[model samples]
Target: MPIPDDLHIQEAATLERKAFAAMESGHLAFRQGKISAMELFLLADKWELAEEALRCLEKTAQSS
Candidate 1:
């Protein structure tokens, strides 16, 4: 398997951070009645995906 470059790892980290921020925003929106429960769930999924991607990249980087 090919190892991820520094740029790829950096991008993955940034994506995870943005996903977390978006999830937090979604929670605030839900609390304020600005978004539906389904929307919040979708944001949670997005965060999970980002988190997984970052973990995979980090693991690959470490192994290589």
Candidate 2:
């Protein structure tokens, strides 16, 4: 069965949010002195998120 486009979009959005949350948690852990915590964060980033984060950061820097 073919999934509807709307559902696909919704699912992608949900996954992206989860990935972002994981990355954020990893960063927090890293800041708090947990080096190994970054692995989980990167795993999420690998799911088409790290590029987005990097782009956003770059844009912010450029605008500043």
Best by lDDT: 1
lDDT of 2 by residue, 1-64 (tens): 6555555455556656776777777777777877665575566548566457555545544454
Task: For each candidate in the order shown, give its overall lDDT on alpha carbons.
Answer: 0.85, 0.61
Instruction: For residues 1-64, write the lDDT of model 1, one tens digit per residue.
Output: 5645776678777877888889899999999999999999998988898889888878776776
In candidate 1, where is summed lDDT lowest over 10 consecutive residues? Answer: 1-10
Candidate 1 Cα errors over 4 Å, as ranges: 1-5
